[model samples]
Target: MRLRLLVIALLTVSFLGALDNTVVTTALATVAGQLGALEHMSWIVVGYTLASTVLLPVLGKLGDMIGPRPVFLSSLVVFMLASAACGFANSIWWLIASRVVQGMSSAGLQLMSQTIIAHATTPRQRPKYLAVIGAAFPVAILIGPLLGGLITDYWGWPWVFWVNLPVGLVALALASFAVPRIAGGGRARFDIAGTITLTVGLVALVLLAAAPGQGVMDLWMLALAVLALAAFFVVELRVAEPLVDLRHFANRTIGIGIAISAIVGVGLFSITAYLPTYFQMAYRTSATVSGLVPIATVFGMLVSNLGTGWLASRTGHYRPFPIVGTALGAAGLATMAALPVGLPLWVPMAVMAVVGLGTGAFMSLIVAVVQSAAPAGETGAVTSTVNLVRQIGSTLATAVIGGVIAAGVAALLPVGLNAATLTPQVVHAADPALQERIAQIYRDVFAPVFGFLAVTYLIGVVASVLMPRGRLSDSSDVVPAAESVTA
Candidate 1:
């Protein structure tokens, strides 16, 4: 019972972190209008993502150095304080700054939550727990926009940030009482140089991907990212205790799991990011209604996520899930690509469910594979690396897909129709013929993008097939760091 409570606390923290990533998305226009920074509104989302993503490995390594319990509890405290700051902010800049701190703290919460779970459970019991935890992310993603809209309408935009406080307080109390104190390995040398280079490289790379213009500045950013990343690798090789153990990539199971994780990130983000807008433009649905449309996909993900985890734990066989999942995902995406524009809404919803099913199969299983393959005392590092790769993949997908849609609209839209200024209201206000034309342009653009995503899933299927054949250990022994905890 105590163990279950600990898991609940960890999941609550994880869910809160993930929810903030997207919850403000629907309320952005409202925030900008009142806060008076219409041009920089996107930063509200980007700032949080950028801060959290860049610090993932840092926080993970800290968990390994000092202990996950202290880091976890400290993060909960900081996250709540930051949330309060965000809620009380008087300007957009203040809120963005607060959100950056929130993101930094969230990085700890997310990384330590998973690290604690890996320590608290044996390899055999890990899958089911991870599966339950994994469901929080997709659930958060699915409902974030809907919840944001409702909160903004009824209470106000500040309530979006305020909402985290109550949930966070509950999580903090449970964690303080229920979480075990895991000891870290004896003090290791901190890799300051490697950390610096990696942070620079990631910041540059993410900026390059997120930037709207493809100018000389972008080229410079790309070059800087490349040079910084190359320097980071060199530093990691020379450092006494590197932030990330690069050698982990040489292990077959770990390498393959990371590759599949990237693919899953790309597919998952591409669908979730675009579908709501697609519904708005293509079906003329309101934002709230469009947000609800993705529930089909979320439903499928929940069912498959729980089922696959249970089966993996019961049978002790895991390799086949991703292989089957990716194949199903590819088939489903291919069907969606070929779907006609005029089909009833149910048709696309059904297809997205298949993609979600495939995606869910990969979620918890990939983490299990990578962590199971880690050398004792290195689970935190390995887990953080997998998450980092997945996040990078998602960032790249967002950039690439955005470029594709922009280019397609620019080419297909009639003269005088500015793709940059196009919105659902603009389209609705336009003549009927123009609206139909805009809809068809989106259909043409998105179809090819979906087909491209399907091809990526096929590649994932190939990667999954290359994964080592084995059953995860059923041992009750915990990781070295948590061996002292009797519970």
Candidate 2:
């Protein structure tokens, strides 16, 4: 009963965190107008996302040192407090600051939950459970925009922040009652320099990716980010209690698996993050209706994620799923890239379902593969690194894929047109002839973006193809095949 309750609480927290990550997006314009911070509106979401991304590895290390229960509880408190502050904020910068705190603490909730899940289940059982957690991300995304819009339209933008309070409090209470306390080790010490360098490096990189432009990053900022990352690598190698511990990568399976995870992240996030825009611009769907597009992806994730986990648990093999999933993901993306505009709505949804199924299967398998390979006490580190790579992947995808789309749209626009013409309001407000022309431009912009993503999926296919034909151990913490050999 405790275990079941614990898992449920953790899932709720994770689901809520994932929901928060996306929920505010639909409410951005409303927030700017109401708060009178129109100029700084983008920072509301950007600051939160930046803070969250930079802290994943740091919190994972904290969980390793001070125990996940304490870390999780602290994070919940911080997140709840910040959520309340967000609700009452009078200015845009104030709300953005509160969200930054919320984001950092929520990062703690996310990683600690994953770490707890890893510790809670055996290798064979791990995938099945993690798939449920993995499915939470897309599921939250499926619900976020519609929910955010409804709340903002009916009550107000403040309700968007208030929404997290109830869910946060409940998850906190259940977690306190149900989670077992696993205290930190006696000898663990934080690598402060490593953490600082890495965070700075990542923030710089993500900002460069996020810089406003088409198909370009600021050269000076890019240089600084590169230099910081290089310094981070050097620092990691020399530090006694290193942040990431590159030693783990000595295992071929783990090294390759992390690489594939990053690439898959590029493919997964590029679609999920931008496809809603495609719906609004090309199909002229309302914010609420545009959200429905991701439901197909969520459905695909539900089916394949659970199926992959159950199969791996039963059969004790994981390699085959990645091989098949990545190949199929490539195929699905290619088909979507080829699909012309104005088919039945189901056509794109069906393609998204295929892509989601493939990626879901990949998500299910990769967590187990890496966790299964972890040395008993350092599972947190390994899990953190995998997540770290994946986030960095999202960062790269957001920058590169976002840039590609912007560039594509810029190139396709009429002589007098600007990229702003594709905005939901702009597109909707235009004359019928202009709207159709813009919609055609949107279709053209997205086709190449889909093709670009298809190439990434193909890259994933190659990585999956090269995956060693190893099976997961069907027992708890028994040495994984790759780890046993390397160790």
Candidate 3:
């Protein structure tokens, strides 16, 4: 009863955080108008995302140090407070800053749920639980725009943030009552130096990815990000107990799994981040109506997740899924790429369904594989690392795509504007006519962006070759294989 209850509470919190991540997309324009930040609206999402990514690993480590109970509780409090701040924010900067805090706080919630789930369920039952938790992200992606649109249209943008308060309170209540207190028992001093270095490195890397072309920060920022990451690697290797256990990657299965997962992350998140833009630009649909497109993707995810879980249980084979799933993903992406500009709305929606199916079939499988390959105690570090790589992948996809959009916009600049002199902000701030011109340019430029997913999954295909062949039964974390590995 207690375990089940804890899982429910954790799932709720996970859904809330996941919902917050995507729910803002349709609301971005509304937020811009309200906050007078049309030029800087993307960061509202980017800042929260980057902060959440960087802190996930740190919070997981912290959970190992103190107890996940406290960390989780603290996260709820901080997240709620930040949400309130976001609701009442008077300026764009305040909203952005609150999102950063919310991001950092929510990191604990995300990691702890995974940690707790892994800890709570035996290997045999893990796949089902992972599915439940995994469902949150795709569901949120599906629901966010619809919910955000509804709230934004009726109540206003503030309600988007305000909506969290009541749900957060419920999560806090359930967590306090149901979740177990998990502590590391080790008295080793916290590796402050390593922590600081890695945090700096990750922040720099994510910021470099988020920076628009020739923003206030430029080449020097990129260089600094690289240097900090190098320093982080050095410090982690030398530390007696580093925050991120680099040793986990020494296992071939784990290392390859992380790489594949990261690539998957890049593909999945980029599609979610930009699909709305495609709808708005090409189809000329209202945000609410455009949101319905992702439903096809969500439906694909839902069916694939349930189906994959059943297949993994029956066939007892795991490797074939990722292998086949990536191929499907590549195919879907290629199909999407082939769609003509301003193609009928139904076409890309169909393509997105295929992409979601591929993603659903593969994603949780990777998480299960990586976790199963790692030792129990190292779960926090390993889980966080995989998620970190995924977040980095997400950041990279957005950055690269954003760069493409900027370059496309620059190339199509009208006769009066100087391409060399223009900043992204300047381009955005231009009159409605210029904005329309840029939008048309971006729509054309982004068509081939789907090909990037094809490339990403091609790498996944090669990585799948490196995957060990095992029946899902043998791969069972939830249940033992019907036939033994030795057999």
Candidate 4:
């Protein structure tokens, strides 16, 4: 009963963590209106994401050093406080600051969730629970925008933050009572220099991705980011107790696992990244309506993740899922690129469903793959690093594919009067001829983005095929309450 409650609490935290990412996306316009910071809107998201990405590896190391219980509890408390602070913010900058704190704490939430489950369950049993936990991400993302829009419209933007207070409190309570206090062993000293350099590099990279179209400035930023990250690796090698076991990075299982994780990360972003703009521009869907569009993908993901998880648990065979999943994912993305703009809504929904099905199967097994491949003491490190690579991939997709979309849209826009400034309202407000032209422009812009995504998905398929095979190991040394880390 206690374990069940703990699992529930952990899953709740995961849902909340995922919700934070997309919840603010839909609330941006409303929040900007009230705070009058329309120009700085993206910071609300960029700050949280940058902070979260930077912390994943760091906190994973901390979890191993001091034990996860204290770190996890502290994070939960900080998040609760941050949520309350977010609700009472008077300006956009204040809210962004609160989000940064929330991001710091929330960064460890999902990682701890997966790590805890690994502690509690055998590898064979882990997948079913992990798959359910995996489902929370896409589901929360699917509902976040819609939930945010509804709350912002009906209750107010403050309620968006306020809702977290009750759920977080409940999660904190359950975790306190149920989560076992694991004692730390003698892990080597912390690598402060590696941590600092990594932070500088990741923040710069995130800023570059989040910043809009800075030409020469972007090049300089990229160089700094590369230098900082490169220096970080060098520092890690020299450190007594490195942040992670860099030696294991070359292990076929770990290396291939990270490669697969990064590929799927990019593939997933490519397909879903521009959907809202596509819906708004081409179909004239309301923000509320477009927010719900991802639900189709969520549905596909949930079914496949759960089903394959059951099969993997029964058979202890994990390779086939990603292979078939990525191939199908590639095909689905290609289908999406081939879709006509004027097709019935069902067509796009069907394609999204296919894409989601593929991604779900591919994604659910990532942690499992790494955990099975990693040695007893290094599971946390491998898991955290794999997730970090995935984050980097998403950032790369945002930078590269986002640029493609912008340039494609700009070239497609008709000359003379500026079409870039035309909103759906503005376009509809114009004459029929202009409206038709604007609609055609949306269709033209979508093809290149979708085409690029299809190719990315194909690359994912190749990576999946290249995935290294090893016997799935379920011998986790760190069990809750009493287990020890085996070297």
By TM-score, the best candidate is 1
Q: Write the per-residue lDDT of candidate 2 for residues 1-487, one digit (tens) a residue.
A: 6667877888899898888867888899999998887888878877887888898888877777766777888998999899999999998888989999998998888887877776666777778778777777877877788889899999998999899998888998898887666655534578888888888888888777766553345776677788888998999999888878888888878887898788667887756778778888888778756766678877887789889988988887898888788877888888988887767777888888898888888785797788778775666677778887888788777778777778888888878877855578887998988878887888888887788778887887787777778777756543221121111
| TM-score of candidate 3 against the unseen true structure | 0.85
User: Per model, how many backbone clashes are there?
Assistant: 0, 0, 12, 0
What are the per-model C-alpha RMSD values against the true structure? 2.1, 4.0, 5.6, 2.4
RMSD of 2: 4.0
lDDT of 3 by residue, 1-487 (tens): 7767776898899999999977877799989888888999978977898789888778877776765667778998999999999999999999999999999988888887777666555544555667777888878876787799899999999999999999999998998887765545354777787777777877777777877566657677777777877887888898888888888888877898898888766887766756765676556665555666678887887778767866775555677877887888888888877676556788888888888888788777677777777776656677888888988888878788867765775677677877567544564566777666755665667767888778888888888888876543343333121111110
Query: Cα miss at 399, model 2 (Å)?
Result: 2.4
When 1 and 3 are scored with TM-score, the better candidate is: 1
Which parts of model 2 have CA positions greater than 4 angstroms off? 214-217, 280-290, 422-440, 476-487
Ranking by lDDT: 1, 2, 4, 3
List model 4 lDDT by residue over 226-339, tens digit each: 999999989888887777668877777677668777866787765476776777677667655654556787788878888888778877778888888877787887887777
- Model 1 over residues 1-487: C-alpha lDDT tens digits? 7788888898898899889877888888998889889998888878888898899999888888877889889989999999999989889999999989998899889888888888887777778889888888878877887899899999999999999999999999998877778877656688899889999999988888887586999989889989999999999888778899999899999999999988877987756778888877876667766666578888888889989999988888999999999998899889988886767778888888998899888888789878889975777788899889999899989898988888987898888888889898898788888777888888888889889999999999999999999998988787433236422
By lDDT, who's the top model here? 1
Off by over 4 Å in 1: 283-288, 429-433, 479-487
Against the true structure, what is each candidate's TM-score?
0.95, 0.91, 0.85, 0.93
All candidates in order of TM-score, best leading: 1, 4, 2, 3
